[model samples]
Target chain A: MARWQPHASERLVAAALDLFEERGYENTTVIDIAERAGLTKSTFFRHFPDKREVLFGGDTLAGRLADGIADAPAAAGPLEAVAHALEALGRETFTAERREFSARRGAVIAANPELREREALKGLGLTAAMAEALERRGVPDPASRVAAQLGALVMTLAYERWSDPAGHDDFGEAVRQALAEVKAAG
Target chain B: MARWQPHASERLVAAALDLFEERGYENTTVIDIAERAGLTKSTFFRHFPDKREVLFGGDTLAGRLADGIADAPAAAGPLEAVAHALEALGRETFTAERREFSARRGAVIAANPELREREALKGLGLTAAMAEALERRGVPDPASRVAAQLGALVMTLAYERWSDPAGHDDFGEAVRQALAEVKAAG
Candidate 1:
């Protein structure tokens, strides 16, 4: 047996999600996930603090979003800056290959209260990251907050559309459509 | 040792908040909270599922906001209906007398990560409630979601101001001011 496995983290996440779907999140355990991944319990612990954390991916997404917002064109408005960030996310994180996995992950999260709470907290963290990044760009108080809130909504709506099995649009295009819908509603 | 006590739920909540502030949320147990409230542990359990829920007040606020939205005048727009609901909340839930308690509760929740996660989840629930109510009023899909998202932001902004020790505006006034700020930012 190998002392170290490449893509260990990804394997554990896939194993956890599979077990969570097959036997429900409440019924799945760390040992079960580790067994499914053909890894020891210690190895699973090395990747994620717990089963819940396996799906969350830590603060990586938040950091990428903040950096994306910070790196937007200087002339862009707040929402345009957010749009730019979402476009970057499409090119980097939310690529077409990940759509099926995201759809599965979304379903697992929606079915469990514990995962839903974690997801909600993660959503707030992303919004805060965007808000702070906007403030660093010299956008003022409530406007920055308002734009961040709308931007988070845009991401959420876009992710939903992009992850749906029947949908064909890329993440960036979905974000554009969702942003237009939000603006029109406002 | 009277088995039946008046306002047992309120007393338990206040005691839990006090203990949470003094000893921190993780250090405070249900028994300690019940003892502080001069109630039996079973009575505390009867009132709340756990110590964390003592401050949440269950779904009463969601129910009230939904009812308030539903009761708005037929001529009201989606955001106007949300405003009407918030005004009713000022009169009914976030009354002047509860401001001090709310401030303390907010501080305690802000200090603890578990409490913060729960608060974030509760905020999402409130947003979902508002969105469903708007949908019932024949508001369309993304528009209903957008108005509810903005409405939740208005509630959050207004609650912060209303709970500030130095702020004198009532909840309704703060809601109006927040709505205006959001509109201007939008």
Candidate 2:
């Protein structure tokens, strides 16, 4: 097999996760990750601001999701719109390799309390941004919030399933099943 | 007003919150909280394991909710059972004064990333526990996870409402409204 050049961002994340697992998150530095990625500090900084950003890496998914929701048909209800947005965004954001990487990243973050909290704050921020996007589309109060939150909740549950060792389905299927279960319970 | 003696735990929490507000969470020592509560260090230690516990001492809400779900009538569906459990638990756990205190506590936690992550972990743990309880009740595979997560999502949305300055309704009402909106959206 040939050595393929990975995307700069992907290479940075792969390097960070490897270093974090080997030396622990607190012990690993940005320079260590940059070197491991075979990139200079400047290239690493271009992709990510700091060590934590390797895990967070900005809100690209949230922006894409917001755009999807905004472009959804006006006839669609808030929940449907948000759900469609989540589904589309999941396809773009979470590839098979990305799924494995994210699961590993989640485990590392979960092991540390402060890192876990930061992850939670990130989740909340994304949810808020999604809600704002829904509101901008004329989705009214409370419904906008609930739709955004529910969309995120389903996405999370689906991701957890997709990441599980026993989980073999695509993220879109997991999300559909989760939503169906919710509808059934309701 | 007549001075009423509070239980050691209650007194300790009161002192901790007061000192946290006055001197900041990092600046206030355990000893300072103990002295303000008119208790010995041992007494404070007996009630709380650490400074963070004082802020998050009421996790029993999850256990209470699980118990309620376990005891719910067999005729009720999983969602209904969880909703009833939440309504009962909300009334018991969130009194008017407690609501105000909780809102303030949330604000304080939001200001600190570490505290916010701890709060998120606690919430996630509670949701997982609830999912397990639902499984025990024969709620089945995806339904169990979906119901538990949706319940938590409703609680989260309700919390956002309850913590808002304009939010004057009880927690139960807020939850009910959130659920209704979700159902409507679906």
Candidate 3:
């Protein structure tokens, strides 16, 4: 049996991902993951709602984007506010220390169609959160939604490029380039 | 006993959605759906690969958008091409006759989280097809993706409002309104 350790949640996530990679996602269960992490099944539940949530969980990123957008200047346009949010989140969320983790997570997600669908849903959830934040700022219906989606699209494009192991551009620069491309397309 | 139907495919989809609603998505099975549709299981298989596909399986909308973009004028820029595709598809795909079916489909999708995730994936798939079409016309990576996503977002927003029974805007009007919003935000 594995021993109890510090940062049990992190250890559980690392161990679960490792098991998912080694044994395939469908074959891995919460019980199996819990045993691998040397924790009780209840402990696993305390950390994440389910085995699937272990990988796709976390409202932190959404919260970060929402908070970032909410902090934008009062007079900024919807798209401009969204840009500020993306930049703020990109700088704070995609730090150098987390690149490897993000890359590995990306690989795990890319390898599974179910995971890809879940990931896409997560992206839309982020978009919805951003849209709601824009709406709270008094931005109107379709405009707020479209602007938020454009911002999310740029952020997603930047993430795919930035997560490549050979990628040279950091997350913030990649975001800027993507935003520029959006403007150029327009 | 239910009699065999001429429109087996449409019958299967209608049956599946009905069963999904009455019995809850998880409780409904292929056999139940097929029997309710007055078709053999094999007939149901011919129409849809599985029960889930009955709700989430059409690519007709994506194909329409892709073909629309491919046929856009050479002088049209990426964003302009995207707008053309959205208008073209909206005109052809979201016809008045399909409004009731579309509204029922939207309700079914909203009632289930798994279906909602699949819907998002379908939206992204449409975006990818649009992006590929843009690339065929020589638009670059992020620009093509951003423009395609913008068009899809507008289409999605338009579809949601247009599907509402109380909605007054025609499909084309909603599409035009959404596109205008995107332009304004840009």
lDDT (10s digit) by residue, model 2, range A1-186: 233446978888888898888889999988899889888787887777777878887888778888989988899887678778867855777766677777788889988776776677777777878889999999886678767767767777777888775784577777787666555654
Model 3 gets an lDDT of 0.83
The positional error of residue B76 in candidate 1, measured at the CA in angstroms, is 1.8
In every candidate, what fraction of the native interface contacts is reproduced? Answer: 0.83, 0.40, 0.86
Predictions in order: chain A TM-score = 0.96, 0.88, 0.91
Please state the interface RMSD for every predicted structure, separated by commas: 1.0, 3.3, 1.5
lDDT of 1 by residue, B1-186 (tens): 677889999899988988888889999999999999988999988888987899898999899989999999999999989999999999998999999999999999999988887898889999999999999999998888888988999999999999999885599999999999999988
Off by over 4 Å in 2: A1-9, A21-31, A39-50, A96-120, A161-178, B1-6, B23-27, B40-43, B96-100, B103-114, B156-178
Instruction: Show the lowest summed lDDT stretch of 10 residues, model 3 chain A.
Output: A1-10
The stretch of ten residues in a row with the least summed lDDT in candidate 2 chain A is A1-10
Candidate number of the best DockQ: 1
Full-model lDDT for every candidate: 0.91, 0.78, 0.83
Tens-digit per-residue lDDT, B1-186, candidate 3: 454558888888888888877888889999999899878898888777777789765788778888889889999988778778877755677778878888988888888877887777888898899999999999987778878878887787788878999883478788878778777876
Model 1 lDDT vs. the true structure? 0.91
lDDT value, candidate 2, whole model: 0.78
**Candidates by lDDT, descending order:** 1, 3, 2
TM-scores for all predictions = 0.95, 0.79, 0.88
Worst-scoring 10-residue span by lDDT in model 1 chain A: A165-174
Tens digits of per-residue lDDT for model 2 on B1-186?
223346878888878888878878888888999899998777777777888878888668778889978988899887777888878867788766688788778877886766776788788787878888899999886677767767877788788888776884588898898778666754
A1-186: candidate 1 lDDT, tens digit per residue: 666888889999999999999999999999999999989899988888888899998899888888998999999998888888988999999999999999999999999987887888889999999999999999998888888988999999999899998874599899988889989998
How would the docking of model 2 be graded? acceptable
